[model samples]
Target chain A: MAHLGLRRFPPPLMVLLFLATAAGKEEYGGGSGGLRFRREGGTFKVLQVADMHFGDGRSTPCEDVLPAQQRGCSDLNTTAFLYRVLRAEDPDLVVFTGDNIYGADSSDAAKSMDAAIAPAIAMKLPWAAVLGNHDQEGTLSRESVMRHLVGMKNSLSGLNPEGIKIDGYGNYNLEVGGVEGTLLANKSVLNLYFLDSGDYSTVWWIPGYGWIKASQQAWFRQTSSDLQKRYTTEEPTQKEPAPGLVYFHIPVPEFGSFTASSFTGVKQEGISSPSINSGFFTTMLESGDVKAAFIGHDHINDFCGKLSGIQLCYDGGFGYHAYGKAGWSWRARVVSVQLEKAESGEWRGVKSIKTWKRLDDQHLTTIDSEVLWNRGSNEPQPI
Target chain B: MAHLGLRRFPPPLMVLLFLATAAGKEEYGGGSGGLRFRREGGTFKVLQVADMHFGDGRSTPCEDVLPAQQRGCSDLNTTAFLYRVLRAEDPDLVVFTGDNIYGADSSDAAKSMDAAIAPAIAMKLPWAAVLGNHDQEGTLSRESVMRHLVGMKNSLSGLNPEGIKIDGYGNYNLEVGGVEGTLLANKSVLNLYFLDSGDYSTVWWIPGYGWIKASQQAWFRQTSSDLQKRYTTEEPTQKEPAPGLVYFHIPVPEFGSFTASSFTGVKQEGISSPSINSGFFTTMLESGDVKAAFIGHDHINDFCGKLSGIQLCYDGGFGYHAYGKAGWSWRARVVSVQLEKAESGEWRGVKSIKTWKRLDDQHLTTIDSEVLWNRGSNEPQPI
Candidate 1:
């Protein structure tokens, strides 16, 4: 399944932990480095792994499985699936869209967090994540969990934006740039946003999942505006805003907009969105910068559907420690490309973007491929 | 139960209604005049009648009643209850907080609308309303229902804030001024906001009860800010925003934040709020002008509790056509006094606000009276 020849590292070599540089990433609170297009095709592939729910390694038993498969099955099986997918796809970046660890099942949240992202760390692929509803349930506070994630090797997660007050930790943005040292080297062609959807309802009256607060919405609006300003300022002729891909744990209420027939993949369960419609969808629509938002909370829902021009998708539950449909193979949604527009047709902004999913089966079954957006004449569907 | 001597108009005279002046108020789209505190004690008493669920006269039968009481129990019983409460309380202003008529049951919405508000119209008391989920179910759309209400005699409801783009109709505000002809005759002593908490979810995905949208919240915030600016401009020494009393149909999600012990009255049914939060409560909290919010969707809930700082209360099941407990009496919540602050000794701005409830039984039972807010040192509770 691995296509790229020299660039795609072999699974044997990828699994071995690559020693990190002696230079400290201690002050790297995300967005300082490590996000660029592939040298061969200029493709920036993003693999979204949701709800890993990793726990005490082999001690944790996989839930909702057949009696025969449950013998020695544990969180290690989840790790195996992750490595399998990574080996097959060899993505540029991996985004863990929440519920990275089942905090309730772990005695040490730091270890669980580390173990959950170990596959990405070992592969030395830059990864960013947003904490979900169950992520703060273990021995760590939400702040501690986020801090642990921010310090991990090859991690690009931050403890909220630099000076602003956003609700939960890990609310930050990563700028995926064009090729290094060229005219578009420092310029961001694509932006990836990671926002924590929160642990639980802290508001006594609103008993359920905690929602993205008004403050978070305000922060998003400001960030969106700031990004558009910088993008337009640099290239005055290209007034369009840079395309964005947002990652969060919980789905906004708008996720329920799709019917089974209208969407691409399956919706095995209800979308466990917050009871409160915090108006983030409206903000996104107004911003006109975000192209798609990927989330994970409802484990069985793996569909991708466009609502009011923006795509809302899910990463079908990835961890064996978490409850899943018996025979359903855990899967990952892969965004294959974000083409960088080059000067004078040599190939500079985002040119085209596409996405699909890959199952954890032996063949690494690919399905539900679709074009999210295109700047050229090759757009498959009407946006 | 009647407190004032000569100022309290007799029930019989009140019902006669001095035939509305030939000078047609056909053009009165609210805020053209008429909202002033009574001269006797300078108190602005407001009667909240919720969920009248009126239908085509005597043919409509009541629901959830004992076998004996079921015999001649129809919407007329609800009408009788309204009249009984009105006669006993003799309120200065009446506000119908949604579900004024069961649109599904009514063959003629206009006739039903007239019948539902007949008590207030007949008594010639100034009345305003915010439609509920059931108001547009039968013969007309939400706009038609509100248009009819705005045209009714003695009705103060408007078809939304002037020239604004609020979601539903009947989104408007009323200003209760100081006694006529005085130096403070034009000053707004109290601000009453009447917003239509829509009939159903128009945003396809978020299905349930209709919610107050971001647009409406923005309208409310702007109106609040404008009111504050005017108040401060008029009285530079008084930096405080005008005390606001908001009236709507469905409660915001915050209504569920209270326990039985924390609030007064009974919550017999689940809080029938919209699934989406919409952040109206947060906007109100930030505005600092709203002293209390009165809503009516959940028929059996008559509880009044404070969440954060704002008071959220229900008007009980006032309509026979709607569902209710067999033993519980139909009732109305009353805001008895909005004390006008005096310059030297006599009254001027809103100094204190108090609320209570009255049943439709033979004694016209009054219950759960408390001080909502008081500017003077006389405030009972901490908030």
Candidate 2:
């Protein structure tokens, strides 16, 4: 029963069970003020949540239903919880993993826009979103919903906005809080590779025209080499880029087909399926100083595993009833990372990582203070 | 029951049932080897099919049993039947909608590859494929598989052996039998825009990366105008670009999500969720002269419908069973198009199309050769 011969328990059933359990939990207790950050010495505390399928709450009993409803409800609650958490922690910055929307076409996709911009607009907290699958759907039309989410719109003359650059179809890079990250690029303080995967409309059976396309892969290789050159100096160079973080909506090495065998009656469901660009992810992890990979899609409780010396963390969905009832309800996790100072004063590596799960409660308690924290001798102390 | 809202049957079930019933029972015969040529003819036929989960005979089911099994079997048999049909029709060209392989990461993926490619190679025909959901499941490199199947590679070195001209990022254009098409170009004789839909690992819910970013969209618009100017002639011209055709894997005017809905104490399955770029297909359809679109995803049987004045056809699976037990088999289809001529011998429009289904003698036969020939007055007559 343990292995079940590659046919993991049907995904729909798992989703249902997760939902039933999640229903028993209370709504997020943290109010809009929860996501605030306080200066902790020389470093800042931040939260990272990806693939929140906002506006996906519909009681539909279809194969892909849980993700839909979960996305919608989660987005609203997540926003509310994020506000509360921000107020409580007052982190300096918030880093969103990806999958800001369930999809561009979701009836509730407008909610995603609200989720992404509302917090930053309301509290003036700096937040950045890496483009995910849901964010990339739809034509790049002025009237399309995705266009609005990414702030991509035509000017009065029907020309692209000045600051906006369409980097190779969907790849992009930007800086937040003086720290830079590039999706599919290596050279940055934090190299966040936001990959496209591929379109669902294309042939799923074939291996082209999707995420990790050749062009993107080539760009990634070049960027990695460039980062190595900049960051390998004995002295802390001003031009040197920082470590890297890869973010996407789907998990690499896909868990398995949710409905391949049960619904279709085909025998080779999980056994024959492919894994998401494992080689690419591995290469990046090995080649560059990739601190971590934040991802979503497998909406179970957090599972942190390593591949090729690279740490892979499945940051559970920010959407509906992801893990279980008692899990992080309407809440996302904030990770405060500080650089360690070696005896020589050069940035050695990650000095400390403190994670907080912001939950809703009438009064804040120490239990809700911090869920996970790791600090080294060279790490900065809390204020 | 007739007006059953989405609650009654989820999108997946609706699509599955539609495919099951729509897998027509007509038996297709072989092609008539008569060559017909018209210099000024501007008509050509194209076939579209999607989600051919080939090599599912030995597939292991995912958590969901019925749908997976059914989809697997249907996909495999349907693909086989499609091959037979394509060989019989011997059309001018063939277009693989998408999802040619069941799971690119599966152990049986190699077998699936063999099954899916056998017919295409045997026929010595030219075809193009887009990415699909099931295809993005595993570790099978998309670029490698695409290069093998399409006889083209994404070249970073800027030298293309397939004779296609590639951009710096491996994006390129190809001329299939004299008709120029770009893999991801703004313009071509027929602008074949191959989009990169996100992978299962990074937001499976969304369908595809919307249109080329804003900058690309501008280029697309300008390219459309330029192509029109370069190809269209107010007066009779000796030379002009061929009429346009758009190809990809997913369908447009997005369908509903692939989830489960509560139905009589049992949850019903839905179809795959729509992408944010659902509007892009509509926009492309609205582009004048974009006569038809070929896609593959719903792998039941061949059906053509019109949206926004554009004809859309799903070519059914190349390896799975179709619908009816009587019609169940694996196969592909070929489309032959003949451009209509004006009174002055100038190109006017597409004239006619004929579809052939592949079936064994054990199945029932219903296709009438004479009826097919009669449908198009411009049908090529044997010498």
Candidate 3:
């Protein structure tokens, strides 16, 4: 009798086989709002890689390193850089703040997204993303692009069962709660907001890039209100306000308002034109929950400032395919929220969160490190 | 058979007896954040009675409607006004923003608190409170006063297990999620923040009134952050920011920043002195979750305005004992949040929330009706 493909291996070998198959799988569950990472020593670390532009190297083999004249990247170098950043920071979460692939109508968004984030997926790093202006500029609509990128193995970027109800792609929220026994029970200390700032202006006469529409703003406000109400208790004596950060593709017009002199970091390129003062900045200000708004459109202009009490920031582009100034290296932004015992004698929530840039290289050197917000300070910044 | 002074009456009478005894028992559980009033077709109605100074009527009788010169109140009138408001609006939730009782060393805090909110409690109304400056100025410390009011029948005010860690009295958060087919099996939609803005400041330099301390500010920031992080899903795709409103005893310094002319409706008194700029307003602005701040310190001033993007509001004082201008009416703030289907096509949260003044008389007429934050408008207020 011929043996069927199914064979009864020893229990130990069977377990190893199951493990191997599971390891080969590429998609992870897009969690309910309750997904939590193991809180290491009370802190959850996040690394953000913006504007990967992976498709620029899609046609070239991994061994070929594109020269400066090519105005593109070496896929191998990009992957190596990601590996270095991951090993150096070992962040609990990784965020691709858009432009994971160059929008070539011929390029496959799914393939490019996979190639761009393959290292992270293999490492089983939890990750998320928002779309860049260039993402949907090709044959694929933003929704189609999102479909290709969402719900991959170990990936956290997809329209899910628990996402905010919105028309746009990649509009969602995530939470990181403290470890049990380390912090207050049922409390989430850090929140991350990923929004879709559209590619092209569809609203007629707005001009230039697409803006965050009123519908998206409404979704943000509504979802935000729900989260605050859920985690906070209305017990007559202890009111907690949740703090969060926002990530997106295009910068709000407020970014242009921050002068080079007002900033603390390197500014190798001029700030790109932003969406016409869409009330997104005002919405952020009004919600009173977002501490910093991070963006990726102005990849070469890696600088941040306190604009009306919100830190409007930019992370230098992570892909060589993206434009960069001479002497500037590919870099990523590393944001660390301090989870500690607050003044009220509870190891419950974060009081201070800081951000810095990590050079996407072998050394993984950091620069422009600064406190984003300090709970003890009276002023929004240290002044 | 000596009945031990208790006799078994008819079955119905026995049931009544049990209920009567049960009514007097204290320590109702502060909700675990899932408590929601039946959303009357997608509306969460709240009746907020500000500054109800219900004393024991010890110095005077219930009939004495303390003349303008007198600084105390009539217990009977206060109860009657509450009854009238409740009968007219039939609100889902009642909030005694502050000064529910006039603290008198001779007056029992528990009795006064009960008497003031008795009508709502007897009606089985879900109610909450924040202590006013006068709430602790008498025989009882604020802590002692809180102990009396903490656990009462059908009460939503107490040092709850779900509360943020803080050193103050009456600082908690509440949520009202949409009932999924009449049961709360899903997430919360609306969040209400109840904060204790402290009595007199022990911070020697700041004389006169107390202020929101760094500790409380820190707590607010931390808790707000925690809430946002908890409800927002980080699955690489959907990041929802939570929106919320805040309630407290004294107003922050930012209240004074709004000019008398910029306000609408009633300003019977100069905006009462607010806490010295202790950066609470700055904190709210920085956190980006709180849309409006409701306050009750100034019994005579009942106006709200957009000051630096956050609404600083006051609900006209409710107590007859509290100082009111001649011809000024006793009123409460009626806040309602719209629990409609969001753009995301789900009733997962609230988009627009509005607040208006509800007269405490039988008429229950609304004045100062305004859109606190509309879902469709570009501006927070009606343009």
Candidate 4:
């Protein structure tokens, strides 16, 4: 009791001291800055980034390889730009939606490419990632590009030690700062069903010993029923009561305009494979309680029409490339939703909303809110 | 132009045949009987089998997850027993050998859990196979497995249409035949090399990429170099005079042991991780008109001692358990080598091995000398 006041330290000084101590440990090195928001009185801000296709080596021109018009940024340059944006915004938490890297031909190149972007990875903020179609290629035959990305050597050596990386192909649930969230969560939230959707083209290529196969759809249906019980109760156990955000790569619910612009004309130039259908998305949307769906793909900044009271939001591509001809440029932004807490400390409903400014403009234009949400209510909303 | 012996055909009979053919056109069905071998003639027979795991799955047992030992034969059973006796008899061309699937964690139950029998794979004449190490766990990552097997799928698939069936892991290759005599005559003799060693234990755990982690030691150093100068002579106009035979699972100089063995003692446990030095085998063995090297993993019946001046006969495992307490058990045999010219005038090598004998007291005594070739020369022979 002699000097309780003497030992007390200021918040900024305490943070600096904690960081200094963490830096001494080899594991904590490099992870210096991250997204952080402090409100004057209890208000906090969070930023969400999805589908940053960094280090995807489709830069060179090849007739049989990438589409001619689509080739622009090399994987290194794109990844470097992504880190630049992360350093600029310095948000509280960055929620990476999916498709972190385009895994296609050369996995080693992709990995070394990832290592070169180590500075961006070291940005210490807590970030969560989910897998996309590009990440699941390993399941088809073993020789898939996804295998290279998820392999132990590549993942460990290529990734920054501090980044909270998650397998895009697996189901995971995480909670940060009392705001519980699930990425590719099991098949249900309030009786609504969800799934990895796999590669929309081939239903047979399930990953991980086929542990997560199409036959598991039955389990998903059952789980969805179980989740509904939690929401039906007057006082839910969790803080967030709003359904849940379903994260995936492709967009759902056919938007004629986007489809026509993105894929329709490509076939005329000799490309025959049709763009995948949104049948899986429609099925998930039919399930109630799936308030929003978040997806990336269809790099153009656009959104689908609201379907069945569900909002679809398409997180724009993280790589630098302008969509259409709007020198407007590419930008990374995060969406934060405030939920109202009930008397019992459980989330009862939506509270307020906040949208962070573009992390940096590398040619990315509009953010597709509908694609990210999957389904939106008829009611009006604000930024 | 030399002469024509013309015979008049009956119009009614010919008309009947045409009508019958037209009627049966819609009734034609597609599918081959899974177990049927058509015969082709040539001197000196050789057998070819790919992806044989000797000590794999069934050798090592895991608690709760696998069945008890002794109740089943591991995938290595048929291949092991057949090779033991096959190697003793010096067959002209024992073409295929590989994948003695033995792993510390592999259990017999895992091998037999599926209806596929290791014996069925070992059925036959003198043969060789490229090694695969599914039996060894942790030694190969899922990514590496896929990369090595699936990466070459397109190239391998283009070789043969009937060979495109996917297994539990979706791995496959090819088997072609030719005559040793014709191989010598055309100066473009049948040259076959068994490639694909499971996962190189040293670099198996790398995180980002698997197969490309480094150039696969087995493929680059061992198998490829095994017949270097013999096929590629110094003179630009003068091509190498002969084709040779090469066989192995994990190529050579890769991860598995090739030079040493634990005949007896407490050190037997350490013998499991054999030093796989493929240099000598690749350099001296199978050069200058050699036919083939029938090989299997060390866990099975591997007769590594060289033969003739060029060919090194390796008849290791034929699918049953490698070596048993009462000597190698299970029965399989390889036919002598046969050579023939293909439509392209290139000599083709073929072996007609079959597995149907029982593991009786008489069969387990000594290895057949007719199929196994003992080394006779000190000079290195380049095939």
On lDDT, the candidate that comes out on top is 1
DockQ ranking, high to low: 1, 3, 2, 4
Report the lDDT tens digits of candidate 1 across residue range A1-383. Answer: 11011112343432231111112212211123557776567788999999999888899999887788889999999999999999888998899998999999998999998888999999988888889888888999888888888888878777766554446787877776665533444456678777877777654445577777655665666667666776676432255677888999998988998888888899999888766556677656555678888999888999998875678888889999998998888889999765655555432667777888888777989998988777644222222
> Considering lDDT, which of the candidate structures 2 and 4 is the better prediction for this target?
2
- lDDT of residue B279 for candidate 1: 73
* TM-scores for the candidates: 0.55, 0.39, 0.46, 0.33
Please state the interface RMSD for every predicted structure, separated by commas. Answer: 8.3, 18.5, 13.0, 23.9
Angstrom error of the Cα, residue A48, model 2: value is 25
Residue B201 lDDT, candidate 4, scale 0-100: 38
Q: Which lDDT tens digits does candidate 2 get at residues B1-383?
A: 00111012454753454344336521211111111223434534444445555545444322212453454443434445556566555544455545666674355555565566556556765445555556544546655544444443211111122232221111222222211111111112233334333233222222243222222222233334444563454222224343445555555433231122311011122223233232344234223445455555544434454443344544544544222222333334444555445576554433444444443334523221111222233121210
Report the error of model 4 at residue B91, Å.
59
Ranking by TM-score: 1, 3, 2, 4
- Candidate 4, residues A1-383, lDDT tens digits: the string is 11111112454654464455445522212111211123222223334455445433455221211343345545444456567766665655455454554444334544533443344357754544444555433223222333343342212111111222111243332221222221111111221122343443432211111111212222232233334444344222343333544545545424332343442111111111123221333223323445555555555443333444445555545554222222333445555545445475543233443343353354333233212231233322211
Query: Candidate 4 at residue B130, lDDT?
Result: 36
What DockQ does each listed candidate score? 0.06, 0.02, 0.02, 0.01
**Mind giving the per-residue lDDT tens digits that candidate 1 earns over B33-57?**
3677766787889999999888887
lDDT tens digits by residue: candidate 3, A1-383: 00011122444664464354455632221113333434455566789899877774445432212354344436657788998889888888889998877776326667677788898988888788889888876667888887666767766665522422334687767766554443333344566777888777653323467666544665565556655664464221125456778998887767777666898676666655432444576556545567898889777878888865678889888876666654567889998877666576546666678899998645788999999887645223211
Please report how far candidate 2 places residue B100 from its true position, in Å: 2.4
> In candidate 3, how many Å is residue B91 off?
39
Best by the TM-score measure: 1
